[model samples]
Target: MRSAPRSMSEEVIPLVEESAVVGKREVVTGRVRVRTVTDTIEELAQADVQHETVEVTRVPVGRVVETAPEIRTEGDVTIVPVLEEVLVVEKRLVLKQELHIRRRVEQEAVEVPITLRKQRAIVERTDPEDPAPEGPPT
Candidate 1:
């Protein structure tokens, strides 16, 4: 430290100079987006399904009957006889007709169309400062 002059006539003047300093830091220049996309796909598939069907047939009974017959079923055939009484000089019963029921089962192969969904992820990074991923370490 130095003292100032006692008189105003005796005074000292000092010279000074200025300069600039530079530094670096990390800044957010761009952004990265990640999202998922869903897609639908169609394909052919196979499955087993069951269906039922019935068949009926008529038979003639041209004979005399005494009483009504009960419903009878066979392996795949059922017989049901219809009876009626005829009024004449001689009161008697007769067989009107009969019904035949036939049932059969069969299997078949069929193709079916099915729908499926698939998902995929997409990542996009846009930054002019860093173009390549392996260019620098994060």
Candidate 2:
């Protein structure tokens, strides 16, 4: 088919695409509550404790020596010698007395009262619309 020729003056048209602005905001979905609980229990504990006792005794030994004897310990018994100087024709060292110390150990049963405490935390969740949720929120 044949078409007619257009006029010298013609109108112009412009094309455009739609656009929008997107933003984000925070929202409270649920609330969390926490509480602590304390508990106490009684129990018995056993242990072995050691203690030592000493018994001192004085023994008389009158003897003459050139010098004083050194303190010695035999087994659990300790021997401490005492000396004195006598005035005669010349000075002489004499043994006055001796002290014997013995040590003994004894064991017995004892009981004591004690208190112990334990604590635990409990959590509860609540929503704005619903009081309790069946499962965790996605």
Candidate 3:
């Protein structure tokens, strides 16, 4: 079977507007006034030959649509570090330091022989010692 172009109908239908989008099979059946040709035999032709009709149909063209993946810029992501604060408090010590009064009750120097004067003694002590013990004692 051979297909005929529908646009060829445009060549015959000069009355249709040029910019009109043709729709699906629109049929218009209207009556047209016509004068009959008559001769000697008068009782012949029918009065109303009203079967004139037109059908309009339209075909849509194919279209294409595309969806792509969403893209994000590097600036969209952000990183932040958490920070904490520390506070220091100072303490004052209230101490009463009692200096020792070395009562210089020098045991009357038993007139020691100059030979024994060069003697030395060793002693063990504990408390972290304070400096400069002075003055006459009780």
Candidate of highest TM-score: 2
lDDT of candidates 1 onward, in order: 0.79, 0.84, 0.31
C-alpha RMSD (angstroms) for model 3? 70.2
Worst 10 residues of 3 by lDDT: 95-104
Candidate 1 — which pairs collide?
none
Pick by lDDT: which candidate is best?
Answer: 2
Higher-scoring candidate on lDDT, 1 or 3: 1
Q: lDDT per residue, candidate 1, 1-138, as tens digits?
A: 899867657667877978788999987788676768889999988877677777888898867867777899877789988887899899777877888888766677789899999998887888856654654232
**Order by TM-score, highest first:** 2, 1, 3
Cα RMSD (Å) per model? Answer: 11.8, 7.1, 70.2
Off by over 4 Å in 3: 1-90, 107-138
lDDT tens digits by residue: candidate 2, 1-138: 888887688868877978999999987788776778888878666666778899999999989999899999988889999998999899989999988999999887666666689998888787756765457532
Candidate 2 similarity to native, TM-score: 0.72
Q: Write the per-residue lDDT of candidate 3 for residues 1-138, one digit (tens) a residue.
A: 998767653445557566768678854343222333333322333343233333322323222213221222224222222222223263322222222222222222223222212323333332334332354221
Error of 1 at 63 (Å): 2.9
